[model samples]
Target: MKKLSLLILITVLTFSCGNKKSKSESEPENITQVNPAENYSGTASITQGIATTITEDIYTCDRGRKTDVGEISSTDGKTWIVPAKTHYLNNDFPFATDLHNSCEGLNYDTAEEALANFNAANTITIDNDGETYTAYIFADNYFEMYVNGEPVGKDKVPFTQFNSSVVKFKVKKPFTIAMKLVDWEEHLGVGCEENRGKSFHAGDGGLVAVIKDAQNNIVSSTNDTWKAQTFYTAPIEDLSCVSEEGNYRYSKNCSTEGGQDGANFYALHWETPTDWMATDFDDSNWPNATTFTNKTIGVDNKPAYTNFTSIFDDPEQDAKFIWSTNVILDNEVLLRYTVE
Candidate 1:
């Protein structure tokens, strides 16, 4: 009898231990997944991340791919373009150039109007603060220009050449801009210091001012395309703000492991203009918004970790939503939970 009682007690304790072990292993202890219930736009608020100095000594693989000029990044230059040696003498290059000899400041209603309207054909201004400017329509032979109305440099410079004299110049409050543009044959043997590696065709040749700032900084620039190269055009959009084109959205998750319901929550926001609606909003498209474990599986087949989805609907705006995960918060940082 004593042996049997001892055996029974042992069996009971063993089963209890087994049950406890099974329960502990059935649920994950440290991992939680969340799904935001909101739709966010491209112009969402961005907080500054951790700051660190960049140097050539720290050669990280990812950072090495991007062009680095001083501390500024070429990939991040929405306001500037890559520095090139040669540029267009005519208004053919996009809306980037601010000066050039080929631009005519004529066809104005008055002299005051003439000063206001720099480029005659295009709606562009070359010398904005200049008091007096000259323009000439010429055909054939070569080209050149001199500041303050006289040429200190060589004349009849061929279209195949580029002039370094066409640089940024700012003198006092008001100034005079004089330019003489000529067109001619392809091989005039004229040379330019900047156009050593560059080539130009006779038909496309024209005068263009390379755009730069007062500090000699290249604001907007482009170089000649290779003979074998192809060109594609992209429409301009605002950089400081995000575009509402396509289905644009952002998301994040917040969860806990020891809550009463054993789950967490999330928030979502987006713009739903009359034309663009979030009715067709697809959450599965979001890479990070998936549930951890499918509840369709029975408990015995389920993984130790299971996450629930929480979504948010807008209060003021019709196109906003907030989402979150439903996970029991254990003895963790649940009290400090907050949404961004």
Candidate 2:
């Protein structure tokens, strides 16, 4: 079924995501930065970035959701994985996390370490003529970023643990930023994970970002202005609860009362367009991103987020956490915006 499919021309970036490895070393500087585009060695086919369709009948929370990769871990294994009990990454996710397995991104031992790594002395040469800017970002699970059709970098950890990042990149004005956002799943294509007390609990996702120039002037941030489209949705109790008007995909009416069982629940998946990450991709007709609050995203306690409020939650920046209409049910989402 070509459900909610929209075809349009978009112009860059390599879409073969999930290529970056998790960090196991302490020195991120010594760790090589991998270009996600290089991971795709296949020909430029229509299905290059496409997602496979999933089939299952709509089910209630108690019935359990359908999944192919079953039980990555038991219900007890499903918990919010944070590295420390208190504040970490007090400055920002300045580099790829060395812990690799921990949900935390990058951490600095002291203020000097963080400043030395992220301050003005630091430089990224992606585009020679481009100015340097720090992209402070927080996401529920994972995100891969592209600037002007080139690789910026992907989250070191792709799934399960909540993580954040501050990518230092150089890009000229009028550049396009494309990000592939995945909420990550322990239940695989079903989009549910074991967490809290439920084995088949449905997890939510949110992405917030703020960009600043050398002088710390706000350049861009996540908001309703950006275009967002959901690629995967699950734990749906009723298909009738979902609807679409033009580009606005709606699943807010679906039930989120995840019961212990989700093995027989339904999910929806769609193929991504080949050039959806291109700089010229026409997203004018796409629905505007839906914004959520810190409480709504449940980021009130995560130090990965609370530690960076100076930038991400700055009143001057006024950046907002964003996601597809239904943050709880939507798993994979694509976001885009051009910085003019």
The TM-scores of all predictions, comma-separated, are: 0.18, 0.68
- Compose the digit string of candidate 1's lDDT tens values, residues 1-340: 9999999999999989877856566867776552121222343222111112232221112211211111212112222111111112333332211121222222222223323544434322334563222222111112332333323222212332221122233222222222222222111111111122333211111222222344433322111110000010011011222233233221112111111210111111121222111223232322221122222211222111111011011122111111111111100000000001
Per-residue alpha-carbon lDDT of candidate 2 for residues 1-340, written as tens digits (9 for 90 to 100):
2332322211111233344455653336655774322332312111111123342221112233222222122122231111101111223323332212233335543322454555543445667888887787777766777787666656655554455666778878988888878776655545667778887678888999888887878999999999898876777655556666766677788888776766555555555677878888888877789999898999787666776677777776679999888899887788999989
For this target, which candidate reaches the highest TM-score against the unseen true structure? 2
Off by over 4 Å in 1: 21-24, 27-32, 36-39, 43-340
State model 2's lDDT: 0.63
Per-residue lDDT for 115 in model 2? 48
* Candidate 2 wrong stretches, greater than 4 Å: 1-106, 109-115, 118-124
> Which 10-residue window in model 1 sums to the lowest lDDT?
330-339
Give the CA lDDT, 0 to 100, for residue 250 in model 2.
75
| Clashes per candidate, residues 3 or more apart or on different chains | 42, 12
